[model samples]
Target: MKRPGPLFTLLAGVVLAGGIGITNLVTGTGVTPVAGAANAAGAPSATEAPRTEPPKTAPPKTSEAPKSDAPARADYAGRVEGGGASVAVSIRDGHAIAYVCDGKKVEAWLQGVTVGGKLDLKGPKDASLAGSYNTAAVTGSVTAGGRTWRFTAGPAKKPAGLYRAAPKVRGKASKAGWIVQADGSQVGILTTDDQSAAAPVLDPAARTATVEGALVVAEPISGVDGAGEF
Candidate 1:
């Protein structure tokens, strides 16, 4: 009998292995052949991964100023009753001032911000006044020293809006001032080279008066400057 060479024996072994792999595939044994089976060996493949997408991220949050549906008025003055406290508000070029005081005590020099059809004024000592108005009158409240009071004011008078005057006595210069109260009263002072006087009581219906034989008048303020001192 003739015997097969070593090379022939090796070829026969490979054929038998391939036949067994084919049989395993046809029988659905779930077994993969070792030849050309890099994935089955748990090795990384050159083909791209499943191509998964990244997760989505959310947008950032932002803070902005509040919007209003009310129209803007340049100058305003308001008052609250019962407390005898009053407010003078002025606005120009979007800047404003609110002065809350009794002209004697319990006063607050509040800053005014341009608020719609309404006025809001605050001060350095935690005093504040807020209200709404038209060309005729203003109504609002003032909060100062932990208390809040309500008032209504008008615009047809002096010391209620703006006042400015320069008097000359015997060619000497003097200064005078007056403010109208929400209670239909007047508060004023006169300053000369030597003295200053208290608020003069005047007829609520009059804008000019004679005090100590001195002619006094209260003028309307038409401008605002962030609660500029009286």
Candidate 2:
């Protein structure tokens, strides 16, 4: 047996190292790619941005609308179709009261319960009024003295509505009604027993009227008060 030279030993070592490398590759234990190895080392990669879920978004909000319904309390005044008469209506709760006058012999006081802004009122001598109302106005037709007329009445403010006066003048039964128009005009009628004539001027501030020679208190008619005594 002879000793191997340094060159021969070096050659043998090189061959052994090559064989071990091939065996590692075949056994699935070879060094990975630089990029893959770095990724596996738990370092964040430029190609893979930090996984961030899209910002959670909330749905848009909505506002609720107010409810629309018939008014619980209201007063309206207007003229008839031909302007031959003035009409006034007052409503409180579900009850309604109305008055129509020509400032002459044609006059009526009507009352009834309102249903869903609809009015169907009846008065003396077959007088009747039918209509529908809203927050703005009332539209309806009235029948009296064998005649019918359509009318539209707008909202009436204070000092402009229906007024009534009942007092005994010269010991006789007497009654008066006034309709203060929205345009500052007015019309009314006074009745004593079977006679009818023009009504006296009514002072809204004082709520009074002078009848013949006597000063009488004028009551504002309202559906709340039922206007029953009228």
Q: What tens digits encode model 2's per-residue C-alpha lDDT throughout 1-230?
A: 99999999999999999999999998978767676676899888878879788998899889787554678888899999988988999998888888899887888889899988899999999999999998999899998767789999988876788898888878998889899977778889998886888898888779888887889998997654455332
Best by TM-score: 2
Candidate 1 stretches with Cα past 4 Å from truth are 1-78, 157-160, 164-178, 181-184, 188-220, 224-230
Candidate 2 Cα RMSD (Å): 8.0
Highest lDDT, which number? 2
RMSD to true structure for each model, in Å: 10.0, 8.0
lDDT of 1 by residue, 117-209 (tens): 566777766888777765666677878757788877565333356443456645677655545654555554555674555445544345565
In model 2, the runs with Cα more than 4 Å from the true position are: 1-68, 223-230
Tell me the lDDT of model 2 at 30.
74
Error of 2 at 104 (Å): 1.0
Tell me the TM-score of each prediction against the true structure.
0.43, 0.68
lDDT of each: 0.59, 0.86
Cα lDDT of candidate 2 equals: 0.86
Residue 32 error, candidate 2, Å: 51
Q: What TM-score number comes out for model 1?
A: 0.43
